[model samples]
Structure formats: C-alpha cells, structure tokens
Target: DLTPRQVTLRDRTTIATIVPFSSRYGVPPTLLQYLSDTMNKEIEGGDTYPMMDTMTTDAFATYWFQNFGAIMLLGTYASASAVTEGNDWATQCLGSFYIKPNYTGRSSHISNAGFLVTDSARNRGVGRLMGEAYLAWAPLLGYTYSVFNLVYETNVASCRIWDALGFKKIGRVPGCGNLKSYPDRLVDAIIYGRELGGPLDEQAGEERFDKIRFYLKYGTYPHGADRAEKSRLRSAATHYRLREDDVLMLKGREVVAEVERQWGIAREVHERGHGGINRTTTTIAEKFHWVRIKETVSDVIRNCKECKDKEAAKTAVVVPAKRKLDGAAEEYLAGSEAAPSPALRGEQEQMVGAEQNDEQFHVPASPPQADKTLTPHQMDGEPYYTSLEYSGQTPNAFQTEPHGDLAPVHLHADAALSLDPQIMGPMRDDFTLGYPQLHDSTGQPQFAEEAFHIGGHEVGRGRKWEG
Candidate 1:
C-alpha cells in the first residue's frame, strides 16, 4: 500500500536555491540531458527561438544584477511515502516577480510581476496560486495598483483568471501575440488595470464651478494668469474694491496692479475736473472715500465756450417774440378827448373841465411828421430810429438833437411839448417846428461834410456817397 504525500508551496525571500530543472522531477542525469537536448531542438524549431535564446541563465543573472539587490526562487513539491517507488517525488521550480520601489513615479500605485510554471506542473494550479500570492502580497509591499501591459486576447484561460481577480482591460495594441493556435485567431494585446484604493471618483460640477469662480476672482487659472482677468475685474468690481489692499496677495498680482493703476488714472481725472472722469456724475474717489490714498495725479481737459456754443447750436430752436399790448390801440387812446363844451358860465366850466381833463387824462401827442416821414439815406447805410417825440419848457425843446447814426436819444425837461391842433389835425404835418433840421427830403444831411485826408486833401468826401 502507498500513501500520497501532501504538496505545499511557500515563498523564498533570497536566492539560495540552485535546484536544477531536471533534478526537480527526479529524472536520471542521462535522461535529463536527453530531455534538455530535445527541448532545445523543439524550441529552436519553434517561432520562440529568438525569445528562448534571449532568456538564458546568464541573461537572467544579468537582469537580477541590474534590477534587484537579490533574487528569490520559490518552489512547490509533492512526494509519495514509499521506498518501493525509490522515494518517488515531484518538484516544480518557481521564479519570483519583484517590484522595486521608486521604479515609477513617487506614487506606489504601479507594480510589475511575472510568473512561469514548468511543463510537469501544468494543470496543477501552481501558476494560479503564484499569481494569487503576488496580488495578495503587492499591497503589503506598497503598491496601489498592478498593471499588466500585454495579455493576449487568445489566451482566454489567463484572461478569465485575471478578469476574475478584479482586473479590468484598460488599453490594447493590435498584432501582439501568436494567434494561429488560439480560437480567437487574432493577437489582441490588453492592458489590465487594478485600482488599489487611490483617488478615483468623478468630480462634482459644483466643484468645477467653484474652481472657475476662483480663477475669475483671482485672474488666474490653475497654473497662472489668463485673459479672463479683465472680465473677472468687471464682474466683481465690489469685491475688487473691498480687497484692494489684498491685490498684491493675488496670484495674478500684475494684472490687479494694472487695473488699480488704471483706476488711479480715472481718479486723477475726476480730481482735476468739475465733472468726474468716467464722464459720469459719480467717481471712484467719491464712492470709496474711506480709503486713505490722496487724489490721483492727472489733468482734466476743459471744454471752451466755443465748443459749448457749437454743441448748443446743434439742437437750438428759434422762438418768435410774443405780443404784449397792441401799438395801434395805444395810439387811438392818446389822440381821443373824453369831454366837450357850452356858453359863458358853461364855457368857464368847460374851460376848467378841459384843463382838468388835460392834466388828469393827458395822452401822448402824435409823433412828429419829420420823424415819421423822414427818409433814411441808402448811401449812408445807417439803421433808422423808429419815432421821435419831445418834452420840455419850450415846444419840442427835447427834439433839438437829430437822430444819431448808432442809436436814438431821449431828452428830459421840466415842461411838456404841446402839438398845435391845426398841425396835429393834418396827416401831413411839418412837426419840426422849433427843431433844427439835419437833413432834407433828398436824404442829404447838412452834416455831410468832406472827410479830411493827409496833407489836408479831401479825396472822396463831398462827393455823392455810393450805396
């Protein structure tokens, strides 16, 4: 009777094992040598000849020397408890998959692993156990994730095993593996990704908006200032003013300083002018007077009267003069006498009444005929005085002066001028009774004397003036 020996596998942390490949399976030296030769011939005849040649013992030793300070070879064994079978035993060689720290980024989320099983160990779950042990030990060795860069899609068993062990396909490359013997018939290399509890969650929209707001407020993106600085300033004007002192603390301090400089310029403009800069009634200085800064240094350009007049002329409207009292009605009232007369006592009464009426109800006399009908000279080209009247101790004493070329004069005296009824009754009266005449009907004035020239010679005067 024979008892089967239990098989156990464990990790070896150092390169102490030098187990020969043939000795592990209990084969004789000659048979093992023959097996090695046959395996070499098979490999040389296969498409993996270049790979097999490259993966020699010397190459493995060089790889270990270059990569790790030490290498560990693990094993699995099975034995039968019987001397009749001449200590019949089975052994499998195992190689470790080492991941050194700091090979990638400072983050320990990435790791590398490799696994190989001997032909005698096929279908015995050795490879699967090795892979599972690697996955389980990687986290304790400070790896956040394990990435498998190349896994052939045609290798369905391995793909299923890795997929079952919480790894997902992340990327792929085409024509990567030998696919002729596989059912998929295509070489689709896959990248398996396993997340080992790092930051991996979808960012909220509110968080994104907050980031945008921060950039807008500070005039900077995540890295540095951007063109949105001005827009941010315009949007948060109040906030900018409130944080004016903190402007230097902002990320885009230069942009804020530029805006502040422009603001100072605007303030200076307002300080120098009656109306503020911004062309607005309000100003930054006036609005934010609590700030301790003095007025800004700048000059305001003034608008002259001419400019004002030109601007006013654009929309000015001409208005007609309004009539006050009618001139024709006033004239009729001046000429009409209110009362009348009779015989002796009645005559006296009438005389007294007339005097009383003359004193109390006196009216303006009709304007002088000379003034009313006097023709103006077209040659003199002088403006005409409208009407002439006199008030004085003597009749028409105030009418002494002729009308001036530029303006009409009104004279004052103690006595009033009385118009003769006979002369006033006529429409064509020569009312220049006591006044000296200055001009004739032909529009030639007596004062039309010659103008003196140099050397006492008068060249053009005394000649008829041309219009």
Candidate 2:
C-alpha cells in the first residue's frame, strides 16, 4: 500500500507521479518494453543520443539497467482509479533516467545519469520535472555531485533544462558524434556538471564562495590552520567559477546575487513586465543565485509602488456618463464609435449606358429590343419585363399609377423603352398583371418602391445629393 508522491504534470492541470523503479526488483513488462523502445527510437533518429552499433532491446536493458544504474520514472494515468497494485500507471511513463556511479569507489560520490523522454511525452515540460527529480534523487542517493558526460550540442531541449537547473557546461568535445542523420559531419558533444545542491551548499552562502573565488583569483588558499579545511575549500573551488565580470558563478550557471546586488537584480527581473512574487522569484532564481530569493522577491514586490497601483486599479470602480453629440454636420459622441471617413466606405456601383439629350431619342447599342410597347392584353405570352436601358438623364420619379385609361402603367426613356406615343401605347405595356383576368386589377400597380438607389446612391435625407 505504498503510494508514490504525485505531481501536477506539465500541463499544469493533470496529476503525474514519480517513483523509484530499480532494475534489481525487475521492471513491469510493459514499462520495460516502453523504456527499451524509447531508447532504440532515440538511437535510430541519430540525433538525441549517439548512434550505437546495436540498437536491440537487449542492448538497451544492459545499457540502461544494472551495469549502469537504476531508473527513476515520472508517469501519469487516465484516471485516479487506474493507479493500482499491478503498477498499470507506469505504462503512461512520461520519462525515465538512470542514476549510476560516474567512477570507481573513490570518485563514486559524483554520479552520472542519462535521461530519456517518451515520444508521446515530448514538449510537455516533464523533461524539466525529470531533471528536477534527478537533482533531488541523486543527492538523497548519497551522491554529492552529478554530471552528464556527453550531451550533444544539437540537443537544445536537454541543454536548456540543465542550464535552467544550474548545470554548467564545463567542457566540450568537438565533432564527437558520427550520428546517422549527419552521415558526413560529426556533431560536437558537451560535458555538463553540477553540484547536486548537497552538503556543499549546507555552509552559509557567502561563507562558501567568497573564499573560493579568492583562491581561483589569487591561487592562495584561505588563511586557515587545519589541512581538512584547506582541502575542502580547494575541492569547492574546482566547481565554482569566477567570471570576467568578477561575478562568481558556481558550475557556470548561477551568478549569486550578493547581498548588495540582490535588490537590483530582483528589481531588474521585476521590471520585466512585473509578474507577482512567485513569478518574479522564479525568473530571478532561473539565472541568479540570491539568498532567501523568494523572501527577497516578496520584499521587492511589497515595496513595488507599481504593483500596488495596479492592484488598486483592478479594484477601482468605473464611472460612466451618457454621451451626446451636437452638430448639423456629422459629429462623434464622446468616447463612442466615430463615423468612418469617406475613404473607409465602399462605393457600391455598376456600369450604366452612355448619356443622351433629355429631349432626344435613340436606339440602344446592345441587347437590341424592338422599340415598341405592349398593352396589358398584348403581353399575353411575351418575355418583356420593365425596360432597363434609358436615354438622357434618369427620371425623377416613376409614376406607379395614372388617371383615366392611363391608370397603372410602365414609363421609361425613348431608347430602351421609347416614350413616343406609338411606343407608349395609351395602355400599360412594360408590365402585365399577374391576375389579368380580374376587372379591378388595373388600379393596383404591379410593383412600386418608394426608396430607390440610382447612380450608386439613395436620394439623400435633406441633402447628401445635388441640391
């Protein structure tokens, strides 16, 4: 009834768990199959790990298991209930890494680990979780230091994770990997190392590095009486770095933001869009090593006049007033949507026939229709609707109804539908009644529109047209 510690997975939502799965106890068949499969896949791709002579599952077991070390797994499940006695959840493994001795008994305190993430689990931030777990697990496993002997430079994701976790790129081996993907070129590999944040960091922060940087600078040991103390300081100095900027970095990563520089560094990070305490602290800790950084960030954020103002603004009530605009011409109401300028409007228009004299008559140049009109009875089985073509200036208004025998007729220009008396028969022609059998249907105009668009415009309200 042992329950592994659960973590909220990379998605920041679902639950993931980490557990120790030792080779001695034997791995679950499915989980071992997955681990071996993932390693072989990485080898075949010839980019992540070095290309090996034999990529068989047996080779993977020997390489990843016993002869090297034991594995720690980060895994998740479909549901909480799926976590059971048989370890079914391990099939959903996010990633697995082996922790083993980097050297024989004397230097075994320094451990090495190889990390592999499942293809299904790439880019889920679980790689970082695996890295973080390595730091924690390695130390508890009695290892004081950790190292990765050959991380390919092309493995940007792995480099980024270790960099953020404060692992230093201490050495490089140029053109070492004859990878399958790069048949003609040899890819360079880097050596990365870091203190597992173990007993070495147990000493007070300043008390630890101030003397180390001094020796790396001056080659003089601390003015101490005891041999053990001198030797310890020298050992610590090897991992601590002194930069050209005179900023002491441990293992090539973190620049310890000293007591004096702590505020400025924290403030500098806070000024990068000013995230709240946890965010600001996380950002600062990613690059700079400050003592009590979370507390330092909290103090900085508390004193941040900017954050306080923003907090107040979030809670502040908004007061609004009714808006009114005054003008005979177009005007905007205060804070309301302004009318679009003329350039922003789209003119809706189509081609029309050439113009002619108001008093003249002529034939239309195309789609020649007989220059004639039809009475209601004459259009019994014809294909004529209202005449579309017109001569001269278009009419002001179309009369829908007329007096006497001229009641309810169509009217138009002389070209398309001539107004000549012979053409404009004393009866309606251009239009015919749907129910021509009714005697009273003559009074009802076939169709009429009070508002019409002419020459790409509607007759204006007051005057948006020719006066």
Candidate 3:
C-alpha cells in the first residue's frame, strides 16, 4: 500500500527498476569526441571563414538526433570513424547529411557541409572511399540530392575527386575562398550536386567509381596532360613541315629573277640597235632574239649621216685650175702651202698683216640688204653681216632652224656663270634675270646673247628658259 495508495503522474512514468539507456540512445563518448574534433579540424583547415567549432558540432548532433530518429544516430556512428582518417574523408561523408531539415524549403536540394582530418592521413583512398559511401547513403536519408555548396576552385585535388564521383557542377561564386599557399589570391567557390534517385546504369556507376579510384591513385583525369602536350606537338610539327621550295615560291623569288633578266636583255638589245630604246615596246621574248639585234644594228649603221657625208666628199669630181687674175693676186694665192705659182707669197704677206690688224680691233657693221634670191637654208647658214637686211626686216628673219635640227648645245646656266661682267649687268638690273652661255670644250663662253631669244621670239628678262 506504500506506492499503490496514491501513484502521482510523474511517479507513474518513472520505474522503480533500474532501466539502462538503450545502446542506440547513447553514442560512445570517444566516437562523439572524434566526430566533433574531426569536423572542427576540417572547418578550420578549409578556405572559407566562420567555420564550425565544438558548439556547432553539439548543436548539429542534437538537431539531427532529435528529428530523424535512429537513422541519423546510425549515420553519425558510421561517419565518426571515417572523419578520423582525413579532412577530405570527413567532408565527403558528412557533407551529404542534413542536420536541419527544410534548409531551403521546396529547394532543399541545395546542401552545404565540410570535413576534417590530420595531414598525415591523406592520399590513402580514405577521401574517395567516404565519397562513394555518402553517394550510396544519401537517398535513404530522404535527400533528393547532395551539394557541395562551396568549394574553392583552386583546390585541384578536391575538385578532381568530386568530378570523378559524377557530381555535376551547377554554379559558382567568384572569389569566395582563399587559394592555398597564396592567401591574397581569392578563388571561385564551385557548387556541385548529383541526383539521389536519378537514372544510373550499372556500367555508368561502375565507370564513375573506377574514375574516382583512378584519380585517387594517379591524381589526374584521363587525357589531362597528354591532351595538352599532344596539341602543342601537333602545332610544332605543322610549322616544321613547310617545304623550302614552297617558301621560295611564296616569296616570288623566281618571278623577280626572271623579270630582272628580261630587263637586262632588253637594255642590251636596245643599245646594239642604236635606236633610242622604247621601254614600253620592249618584251621578254624580243630581248633574247640575237637575229633582231643584228638586223637593227645593221640598219642604224647603214643610215649614218656622218659616214655618208664623208664618203660623198671623198668621191667628189676634180676641177682644173684657172689662169691667175694678176701678179699681186697670183702671189697672194700662191702663198698658200699648196700654191702652184711663185707670185702668191708677196701678195699674201700684205693680206696677212691687214688680217692681223682686223683681228686686233673690230666693229660690227650695219645690217646688210636682204638676199631674196637665196634659199632659207643658205640664208640661215650665212654670216650675220651677209644675211642682215637694210630695211631691218629680213625675210623669215625670226624663223627657227630648218627641220628643228639645231644641235643640243651644252649651256652653263649655274649661279657661278653669273660672274661674267656682261652677264652680271643684266642679272643685277633685274633680280629675276638668268644668264645662260654656250660653253666650248675648254669651258669658255663660245656664244652669249645680251637679250636672249628662243624659237624666234625674244625671252623676257625674268622668265625661266628651258634649253
């Protein structure tokens, strides 16, 4: 009757017997400590700031165990040992589990988590093994998919493992995490996810698993370095494969040489012909014709005016000598070296002295009467005194030389030629005046005009003249 008399509501719920806590109810303190320690270590080691600590671990464990029943407890138990192996392993194992449900309401597929491990425990298949285990377990925990919401882009090892696990990248946050070894260089945070219950063939799953294992062992994907190296090698090989002949052709070497040779031959042919070369008429094929060169040169030699004139003079008919006009005239005429009479020397002595006086002092005479009877050629050729008209208007007096055949005279028109007293007078009087003088072989003035004329018209004092 001691307890049966009035059993209180609180007493009723409490049993008198010693009831032990279920083995499932209480986790091993060592395992809990390990999980907490591993998670804390991984979060600290990660690139992101404001990481989880002991308090976070306790909160996560309380929420997970409270809501999800025995499943969460079992997962916690399994993940504890995995985390002790390495940071990567702990991240992969615990990264998929959701401690708080409905994180994004309707879009709760977006999940974020991390892992922890000592440095010495890496590269031993621990990270990959845990990743595979998580993929296998995620669907049973009512998760449609698992996501690595933030992963540093420069974390090559972590990226390789996740990619090999068939986790497709969905998004990226630029410059969200620190690049390892380069604290100042921020890296992109990569978002990755994989469907929990999506279509997955056995072969594809096996292939993916195999790839993860390969990455763990070799630390690279298929065709990574080889692909890049092969492309570089191909480019180099293409560059070296070009032919020397093709290169010469592209530079037009043969074409340029052919053009130069043609030009040389054309110049030679034109010279041999003695015909003024017509550059426009010259052709490549014509330049190489030896027969044409000979023909043209022969024609030029046959028509030479200087040779014809010399031959005509040499073959002229002879004329007999006439009787002497008087003894004085005879002596003067005979005084020549070829004289046939003795009387020529006495008369020639008187004439020679008079000619010497004429050379010493002379004056220009008045214009002569027009010789209307003479031809234009004869009128032009005759001396000025003999050709000038008394009326100051000789017939065709202003006419140019016949047939425009005036010889090309070398005229000294340089500024130094102005030193002549006669030239300096006109040049100083009219500052724009130019004095041009015909030069003899010895560079002395042969002929000069006080006021110049060309083409029968007087040139104005200041006008430019083209000789």
Residue-wise C-alpha lDDT for candidate 2, range 362-448, written one tens digit per residue? 222233234322222224444232333332222211212222121222334332433334332422433343323212233222322
Ranking by TM-score: 2, 3, 1
Candidate 3 on 1-467: residue-level lDDT in tens? 00111111111121111111112235444444445555566556654433534345566456434432211111222222222323233222222222223367787653443433334335433344345545554455567767787777545446545765778879988767754444655666778877766643322222222332233334454233256534543443332222334211112212211222333454455455444334323432332322123323333333344544567898773432333444322222222345434364444554444334433322233244443211111122331111111244322222222233221211222311213334223333222111122223332222222444445566432211122
Candidate with top lDDT is 2
User: Which segments of candidate 2 are over 4 A away from where they belong?
Assistant: 1-3, 67-91, 198-467
lDDT of 2: 0.56
lDDT of 1 by residue, 257-306 (tens): 12234344444555455353245224443433211122121112121233
Backbone clashes (count) for model 2: 0
TM-score of each: 0.28, 0.39, 0.32
Instruction: Tell me which of candidates 1 and 2 scores higher on lDDT.
Output: 2
lDDT of 3 at 47: 49
TM match of model 3 to true structure: 0.32
lDDT of each: 0.36, 0.56, 0.37
